[model samples]
Target: MANQPQDDRTSKQQAIDDWLPITSSRNAKWWYSAFHNVTAMVGAGVLSLPYAMAELGWGPGIAILILSWVITLYTLWQMVEMHEMVPGKRFDRYHELGQYAFGEKLGLWIVVPQQLIVEVGVNIVYMVTGGKSLKKFHDTVCPSCTPIRSTYFIIIFASVHFVLSHLPNFNSISGVSLAAAVMSLSYSTIAWAASLRKGVKPDVDYSYKATTNTGVVFDFFSGLGEVAFAYAGHNVVLEIQATIPSTPDNPSKGPMWKGVVVAYIIVALCYFPVAIVGYYIFGNSVDDNILITLEKPTWLIAMANVFVVIHVIGSYQIFAMPVFDMLETFLVKKLHFRPSFFLRFVTRTTYVAFTMVVGICVPFFGSLLGFFGGFAFAPTTYFLPCIMWLAIHKPKRFSLSWIINWICIFLGVLLMILSPIGGLRSIIVSATKFGFFS
Candidate 1:
């Protein structure tokens, strides 16, 4: 096996890695991490927090929300610290880090599937979110115009990716990411401030939304999934860090962690108020999307919807860039296809179309969030990094790090198991009443 020239293989591999989207650039600044993380962590999921609060009620809801924020932040720090743990080497992709912690093959099996689900699931949900927000904007602004089907609006939303997908690298989309970060903060502000302005609804009920014991159990589980879905930035942290230049003295972790702190603060600002205030205002009567609940101040609501459309546009790209990198890597390496513009066009277009079709079939945004959140996101966001940390760092037994990692893993496993049951049931219940492509 060690017969032929080894240098030839190394050179060929480096060439392909350099060509891949995630690794094509390494000059990004720390603030790039700041806004990109913002765009990634604070997505359409935040809009669902009020409904989640309603399901779990105030006590459990607030507790779960705060716990998730802390747990995910700690796990994220593990990822950043491990990024350049082996000086003179960088684990540039999630799967690469996975391969390092686990054996090469097992790591791919463990991480890639979950990572793909998080990335692709997010894209599918965003497709529905974008289209629905656009429809909301249209209906609010032009109430008298002919009504358009959500199917068409979804297609219109997918059309943007047909163009933006060609941007070729994460850095290329910095402007879009920055704008999305701003829009997220902006719309999040509008959501809370507008609700504050409108004041709480009359006879607001703080009781759980579900009546039966079984129903309450399911809803509580689903609420856990919804909160799990909100802190979803870990999937892309390493990929985002790959863009930042690193050196032995000034490792990437310093800047990456800096950006992550800023992003998390922004996340806290966006998530806490929206979840707490939105629930306080509308109580259990809140729509799955809080924006859909608010009706007054027509122009303001319309603008918020418009802002949602813009923000998801950027979020979609942030998530998709990694998927694109993976696809291109597989094609160029395994299939031996020459990398070209045509290859990228076909791959990205096919992906967009596939997500659009799935989104069209099941446009239940809330249920999808809970389902994907538990089935996919819980593993990737909540616990996988901790698992990776223990495997790589071998944190001292009985130490604080060891205890914390185990705790996260235990909670994450419970989240993965319980939340999916409720999320799946919710999807089935919603599906029974929903007409295809309507």
Candidate 2:
């Protein structure tokens, strides 16, 4: 009879999770994993690759691009493998996995804040990305049309989310995510192909654009952050895996890894051509956004911008679903609010509005990428999984696994420290030049 209360609590908690956005479904297919990862990873950050390469220069730029691909794939693999590590216990969320690796309270403290930063930050950036792209598309298609303020475009973008944010779970958004994946690939192809056809600029300068040593050093730092931002999938890897069903014979990891491999390949296809070909074509003079740099092909660039809008629409939801889960979980579980359509509607709408407002207020695309990328993306996407692997498995000292994990840790930490400095400086400078909502 005494156990009845505990059992009641357990049942109630399970019911709450089932009602929540992320944990409500677990029947997603391998293909669902593929596109969701694609949507989540190949986002606004990809649009900025040539810009990043411009800041990085040739050798270091190419090297960093390749290295980020390898390291993030490694970290993503670790996340997929660890999703069901504790036998029947599956980590349905990033924070849940953190709780397992670091214990209940400490795990929440360490992981939740960083995970929130990555997810929320992505949503905010995607708002600006979606809005700005829409504005670009309008301008490209109708140069004579009255120019719309970016703030209004941003508002139009957020209006879509206000409705879509009510999607109950990851499974519900699969179609959107699939379309998003297609659009991402489509736009990325357009970006690089167009850049290639444009050919190298007349007297293209490959030299670093910075006039001073300090400027060059800081640009290098900001470039690291930009690259870090491109590989932002690790933040959502576990959650993406959570949607897939698992069994002893057919573990989720098998299919999740397959999907991830496909997704990473797509990521490479999208990232490399845009970063390399676009940089090769434009060099240090590349616009922070490659699409902006390609102006001659009006119809094609306009279409690419539309594709960008559609892709980020899906990408925004991919990232926002987790934030919805977090907020709903907190409200229902901690505050004793009853879970219902009203609660969810209010919660999700509020979140979408919040991101939209912030995005409109500070639409500093390049600087936002660098700041959030280094401050949050590096730790979560680059090294946190390695830290978790070591903590959980305790691999033997000085072994290959041990050595590699430590190397990733060292690099990730360095990235975390340096990238923000440059990003912040850029934001400050941009703020001085561009007034709020200007």
Number of the predicted model whose lDDT against the real structure is largest: 1
Which digits, one per residue and each the tens of the lDDT, describe model 1 over residues 1-438?
333222333877888877889998999999999999999999988988999999989999999999999999999988999998875788989999999999989999999998998899899989999999999999999999999999999999999988998998999999999999999999999999999999988899999878899999999998888898898888999999999987766788989999999999999999999999999999999998898888879999999999999999999999999999999999999999997889999999999899999999878754666776797799888899999999988989989999999999999999999999889889887777877677
In candidate 2 the C-alpha lDDT for residue 112 amounts to: 91
Cα-based TM-score, every candidate = 0.96, 0.96
lDDT of all the models against the reference?
A: 0.91, 0.89
Which ranges in model 2 have alpha carbons more than 4 Å from their true place?
1-9
Report model 1's TM-score to 2 decimal places: 0.96
Q: Write down the RMSD of all candidates, one decimal each.
A: 3.4, 3.0
Q: Please state the error at residue 209 of candidate 1 in Å.
A: 1.5
Question: Candidate 2 lDDT, tens digit per residue, 1-438?
Answer: 322222233888889978988888999999999999999999878988998898999999999999989999998998998888876578889988888889999999999999888888888888988899999988999999999999999999999999898889999999999999999999999999998898888989999989999999999998988899888888888889989988776889999999999999999999999999988999888888899999978999999999999999999999988888888888998999999999998888889989999988888754666776787899999899999999998999999999999999999999999999989878876776766675
